[model samples]
Target: METMRLSSSFTKYSSLSSYSSFSSSSSALLQTKSKNFISLKSVFPANSIPNGNRNLTIVSASKADDGPQQQQHSPFWGGESFFRSVLASMESVYLNKNPTAKAILERVHSVDNNQICYDHLAFRTFGVNGHGIGSMANFFLDFGYTQREELRFPEKKLKALWFSPPSLPVSDGGSGVNGPLPRIFISELLVDQMSPQAQEIIRKCTEISGSGNKHAALASALGSLTWEKPLYSEFQQLARESEYAAWTLVNGYAVNHVTISTHHLKSQLGNIKSVNQFIEESGFKLNSEGGVLKVSPDGMLLQSSTVADSVSFCFSDGITESVPCSYIEFAERLILPQFKNLPEKEVREFHRRDGFEVGSADKIFESTSKEQLTRRA
Candidate 1:
């Protein structure tokens, strides 16, 4: 096995040839959260792993700042190693697809000493052929994430659910290093609700591609499209009916957006308003659908996002055109009314407003809409 070191406390080790071959023997590790190092182990049954040249990279985050530290933290459901690997892969692919987001993240890191923490990760899918939230939810649920609230966008013909991640160990004395993990927000378009023509187009593509649930967990991380590229005509027809459907057609399970937890920033850019201003001043266009700053009805959650970056895509017919890809979002979860009396230093993850707001999220989805794209153009 070969080991590769990544920035921060992450380390990657490659061994297996397929994600399916990766299984856990215990859930002990998922319950153990440490402030030091996390141990990772792989026990492959004889010949269970394929002989291919493919590499299954297992990544784990170590908390030691001095040098590489090794401590046993059981490996179950692939443990944190598998979880971190998935997150790292998604981020890598997302950054590669969105240059505007990449540059802004770099700037934010330079100012915050790379203390960046993700607020949540979003994904889009078709609510047909068993490829919706249920397919992706298992991957997180196996590793200690619990399903939260279900949000609906009736006007947009979409429904979504957000999952809360396992709480990290507070043994670090609330240093804010290994804070709460990012939540997962997954939304799916109601394919049956689309026009007959649009429905046929989607059904044809899904049938040709087959159900992608076999390894749906790795789809986003590997940046692989589960379905064949759609014809430009089909894409256009779907777009006329629902832009969300069109976007998901080409993007597949790839990340829709990764939000920056502005409150987690250790610098002056630690609020949504300041972060939005910073991004706009940095030459990136903000999604102006409902306004640059979207505040929750209760005013406890504030959010904003960059317009989706347009990337050149070659259609199934060999015609290529620029289409919206992914975007970056910024969010600030204000301290809950009950926790407002707590001292600043004592505030923790639970002290702030949690989950998501439908009204704010409804507008945030426009980050990839044509209206927002036209503003970018």
Candidate 2:
């Protein structure tokens, strides 16, 4: 929400025309002639999480009707210790791959306690119960996070949910810090929906994973992958049919990416555009699936991300090869026209758009797809 002044040079280079054009037929169908026109109603609902597959127990502190909600959630949902633990785990891997992020952290931490905070942490998981989306959600659900929105991508055969971390008033909510906290976006690959061959490859990976002690296999859901890696040939075959399944099977329960909230970071990095320019100039590649900048149809949310970093993946053949891991994202949210008069700080808290855009997210997912990876290779 903070205003950012762009230097003349960066401003000149940051035009929307500079980004690539999207070719997906779905995107073409959704595009409007006017730059500002976006179909919001079709893209995002007030707060709709698909009812059938979700088991949302965490309730927000702001909701007034505490009747049924009071009975459903845990009293020990979040605390400082648990919050730190999760960030520590994510930072370990994120920092290693993103030098720009690492430098930003160092630069900020040297001055005050205002180090970079994540806008969201994304995880890739299977559709199964204990070792799938449910398992990852349990970790946050137990800490007072409530599911906010469910996004379904039939084209990609993916279903994802975004959970809002608890607010301060929630007695057992996140980190004891009151304010905008990062969301947890967990997506599952609908393996059963894939072809028989793709399904079998994923099934084999999961079966091999579950063959161990039940507790251990369950633990691997959000932990480092424990199953033996699939052969590169198997990976390639699955990649041809469903990249989501192939990525999940290889990097089970891995953190897909860490997002940086531009609204929160504008005071430091100028804006999301500036952040993207800085990262690119610093030698990181931005995902060009949709474009370097993915603006919502309504233009409320603007997002861009670095392509996934190549990390070592040991295959069934016992050879370790570099494959996609994770990357950093920058998001700039605009104040809704209805609340444009509010103060910048207040606008961020009160009006900045929250929740993921299906179109933008669909393209964001390509950050790790075989197409992008193959291009990088």
Candidate 3:
């Protein structure tokens, strides 16, 4: 609902003419698109501006609504949370017609809270990270739709949803720490869906990154994210083959690996059949199953069924690591806790490891075997 402005997005070093002449086929690697328009008969029926022929619309929040309505949402917001509803409003309509959004990712060599906030906004589509698409976990699971633009009923749309944890909180006045030193969670989605080749490239990136080889994976991914083809049927056929992974998470708000594994993440990994293969191939040694990742009184991943295993992800260099099963078991028993043998209860209760040092490798890996095992993942 703000005034539209021209954006000087980052472009290739080559001339604009060169980019324009680039091929539009993503069968192999390569890429390069908006959300607006409103119609009850259309996809994004909320906050879309009217354009007669094209599926591009920009509807103001005020105009999108018909009458004065009471806003009913959680007041748990700490002035940092963003809550945009795609109700039968206009904004949702626009994004629906053009689900594609431009993504820009950076190493974030340093802390930038403002940038982190902006990045969260940018992830309105695509996702917060490779974890999965971003959405209000509970709400969208109840009302979200997917791939309907390409697939038919009882298939694309479902009771699935996504989640994005809160941005890193500021721990002020302790050990001389200040703003944005250890909090960043921004995602940059491409303006177009990646081609099959691009998907393969990302897969390779995941593999290479997992293996601790990132530079090559980054180059490969950047060069292969094109979506210029018009093979809807072909893509649909591939989709029918199905190859993705799905893991479970407990809560959407907590960043703890135990609580962050939302259902959306599970489906995004690999499809149903491929997931089965991956599980068997990877020899998934779940800490606790039956869909729980909590810890027990005995200090294990399970405790009288009160604890369960949940999964999440974090990528560095090029590998996107899927932290599966009970994070408690992984972080405490398998992975190092980065302390002088301090217990997790003490670590958490005292709010120690307040900087970028806690998530360091020394804290994440236990032994040579564990490190090697993680790399193979």
Candidate 4:
């Protein structure tokens, strides 16, 4: 299967592989809000990560004398060992549902000297204290990621926060090191904002999961459901109001989708239109709410995604029906003409857009809605 073959553009930009080599010479003190609760501190030296034009660094904030405040370097999270585990875990689940992605991964590795490029990974959660966005963010924050931006969708009763990964120093100049790390978008359904019946059902699911020692489960934001399954009637009711909440109740805090940056694929597939055409021609249906492409106001960012796959789940009543599971997304960010002439560093920080567009994301969230899935079916 000669699926989308990532050009050297993606192969050369994998900074996730760089955290392996750390020097003992330079190290920074690191601490988390609750070191005892979440063991996030690790002692590793600063090393370069490969991201075509992006670099991810993990450090502790420190005050400097003459120059700007320097990022006191800390140990990389999980290092290479943990890095491989994380990718493997995510790939296992993502590939299971998205054969399209599996084909692409196999194709890339078949040629050797290549790896897939991930524009971003998104997770859906309930808007609860220790179990929602705050808890999910901790997982990434432990790995040196910091919150960058927040977005809201009152109509959908949802709120999202985007996190940026650590970056390498300017002295460690390399291709694409100027760009930021692959984003991690975490959104939580406003359960309290839902109808009383909906809220009670969600609360019950959380209660079931919290019955035992949940402290250990807080470390990870992905995996199989920790709560009891809902009755078909309850699930339908929740889905009727907010599919996102119903998804979390059944699927728990798992990845909703992984985004691919079409801009990076330009060398291989060209523009967003080309990418969408290729996927559609390959037999995948795209989200049509805002059309196949959702362009930002300034026309700098464009987005699209495949309709969620119909995954069947058995209700407590012993009935199974297929509903939306997960999907793949594509994003293309245009460089401002003004910044196009500037150096790559300036362009990365000032020109290329970061974060999500409210209207675009609002529709993207519908990928898993019953209406979208039924229409595609």
- The candidate maximizing TM-score is 1
List per-prediction Cα lDDT, in the order shown. 0.69, 0.57, 0.21, 0.57
* Candidate 1 per-residue lDDT over residues 248-296, each given as its tens digit: 9989888899888999888989888888888888888999988889887
* lDDT score for candidate 1 against the true structure: 0.69
lDDT of 2 by residue, 65-136 (tens): 332233332222323343444445455545665454455445433432332446787887766434455556
Candidate 2: segments with Cα more than 4 A from true spot: 1-78, 97-115, 169-180, 211-223, 266-268, 374-377
Which should have the higher lDDT, number 1 or number 4?
A: 1
Q: How many Å off is the CA of 92 in candidate 2?
A: 1.5
What is candidate 3's lDDT per residue for 1-377, written digit by digit as tens?
Answer: 11111111212111111223232222232110001111322211111212222111111122212221212111112111111212222123222222211001011112111222110111111211232332212122111111111101122111111122222334331110112111112111231244555345334433433322212112111222111222333323323332111111111112211111111122332122332233334443322232223232223111111112222333223333333222211112111233337553443211211111111212221211222224422
Superposition error at 364 for model 1 (Å):
0.5
The candidate maximizing lDDT is: 1
C-alpha RMSD values across all candidates:
11.8, 16.4, 22.4, 11.9
Q: Regarding TM-score, does 1 or 2 come out ahead?
A: 1
Itemize residue pairs with steric clashes in candidate 2: 38-297, 38-298, 77-143
